[model samples]
Target: MGLRTIGGWLQEQHVQLHMGRWLLELDDARAEREFTSYDDVRGLAEGRFALYIGIALTLAYGVVDVLVLDELQLDVSLVRLAVVLLFACAVVVTGRAIWVGRHLQVSSVVLLTVVLLMLGTTLGRAADFPTEYLTTSCTVTLFGAIGLLRLRMHAVLVMAGVYSAVCLSLPGALQGVDALARNVAPTLGLAAIAVVIGFSLEKLRRTDYLRQREVEAEQARSDELLHNVLPAPIARRLRTEPGAIADSAPEVSVLFSDIVGFTPVSEALAPEELVQLLDTMFREFDELCEARGIEKIKTVGDAYMAVAGLPEPDPDHAASLAELALDMQRTLARLSPAWPSPIAMRIGIASGPVVAGVIGRRRFTYDLWGDTVNTASRMESHGRPHRIQVSAATHALLESRYTFSDPQVVDVKGKGPMTTYFLLGSNL
Candidate 1:
């Protein structure tokens, strides 16, 4: 996007950026609150390094004084050495002390210090210092220190003012207006350019920070939605390793249930009313299933299906599924909807080995496929309303802990002639 477009967006309601003294700052209170921590991290990262770099460059330049000058000027050499020693002490204090919390403040002081030493060095050799010396000193100071550190607009302007003072004083020290008239333009010109670069860099960093945080917040919301749709463990697996999630659960229990007399009642109510009734009824079932540690498979028309075990195993799968079935009947009985009368449910549970996995590519779901699932459905269809029925396997596991009707031989759909029993209630 163009600069104009980005600037316009910076003023938008979501994250309003305003011009502060010389730099862009958050105008919106909420944006300022959010940006504070991000800006602190940037200061900490940049401040620690900028101090080290300034000290190294200052030390290197002192070596240049000893080698490059025609004669070793003791006063100029001593000045450079003092600046290096001072910078080293600042690094240790800011780098390791508890007051490193004041990184941004330390950084501003470091930049001003560079400008001060450069001025002092020029004044120390007033007669030998040619007008051209300001050009080299100003160039070195701007390029080495300011460019290495990321300073905001106001800080950049402060350095510009300090440099202008040193340049303006040169003409009087040399005792001539010709000195000011000749060299003033170029030195001031560099300071102006530094301001523009500094402002742009600060704006760019803030923009990148805002976008990165947006992406992280969006990812968190999506992961939460995915967890709600699938089991927590299954959702986590799919996120880390995406593919067909399959597992063979040898010991599990499955439950199938349907709203008895649903058709006649649904036909009697308006379409909107019918939908509202279903939503209300199922929401209750969903909450109850969660409380009983049951994983709801899906609801087909008025039929509700769920299972206990597989995704995560429970040795007491049969008992858990059985308790969920009993609660479904009680929950349905208590639900008062726009229907003609009270609702009742027929639930069936079967226990044995089953193959469980997530199905579908875009619109995915977690489900089970095996004889246990089929037997549970058959038990619900063949069993009576307002009652929970179970296969012989499930009944064997629960008869000791739960109350049940006398066993009866019934003709099953896929498998002929199977013995099943009706669940009455819990023993204790």
Candidate 2:
């Protein structure tokens, strides 16, 4: 094999690896959407690239030696050639192990052993005499063993150990040391150098793996947190769209529920206990919202806010909001006993156009802004406990499907006196 042939083979391998990576990206996209288990596919693709690159580089060196060093010749005969060929076959077999999706440990061991044997045989053939051969073999074996250890391949370590011992004992077997001392010393030194290099490489590899794992774990935690705070559809949209902010979302129904006399009740309990109680109540509220297919906007102190439009809107936003408020009132009534301090709830339902989205660069929250959210909050604040209040806008939308008490004119903080109605119950 000449340099040109080796370079061509390497270039071909690079092209193949690049093509495989490109195809793998397409496969990855499809797998992400359709397959539940994608790690296996990803692992196989990565392993294939690693093996392809490793073999190409290793063979390129061999090709360089064969082509550039014309004077260099191995004393080994047909048997040695057959052994080398067998070792090469082993490399290919081990490389294919990734496709089987089996134990990487077993495959690594087999491959490491073959590589060691090949290196040992090549070095042995280059030695001038038995003593020299022993020295050179020991040096190569020791260093190669260290490299294998760095690679974290147990099988390679075993091969290195055996090879090192053979090299050290070669002089004794040949019954000549004085003549081979010069070559032996140099071989031992080279082996020691290889061990140092292997140590450094292994440390770097471990550090890289640790960093990669940390990044992946952090990303998973962030994803989990995002899903916890936002509805699936909204979260997905926010992720796909950069710098997402809610524009003028049209005719979305908003629901606001606040615990009546929650301030006094919260004062009665410890801060931690108050938070715990709130968390329990809110978690339940979240489940109810999800069950009713409502997108939660945000929570303020003791109040729960939610919406039913934008980021995949539903036409029956008013009806859904009405139904959800009724369910929540009923559910909270049953859960009153679980709270450290007994409390009742006042829920307000309203339908109107409003802008809702994540705001703030730091400590951000998905919230609704505009008069609609404030008016809905005021309705809850002024509402009687155990009742659901509805703005005229919301009442009009649900008037056909839900029964409501006659319009009650109420004074609100920001929006003066407004006509609101009590949602009696669902007509359905």
Q: Per-residue lDDT tens digits of candidate 1, residues 312-423?
A: 8889999998888887777776775446876678888999999978888888988889999999999999989898999999999999999999999999987999999999
What TM-score, to 2 decimals, does candidate 2 have?
Answer: 0.64
Model 2 lDDT tens row, 302-328: 888898875568899888888888888
Clashes of each: 0, 0
lDDT value for candidate 1?
0.74
Point out the worst 10-residue segment of candidate 1 by lDDT. 1-10
Model 1: runs farther than 4 Å from truth?
1-13, 16-22, 71-149, 154-176, 182-188, 221-225, 239-243, 288-294, 315-323, 395-410, 417-428
TM-score of each: 0.77, 0.64
Look at candidate 1 and give me any clashing residue pairs: none
lDDT of each: 0.74, 0.63
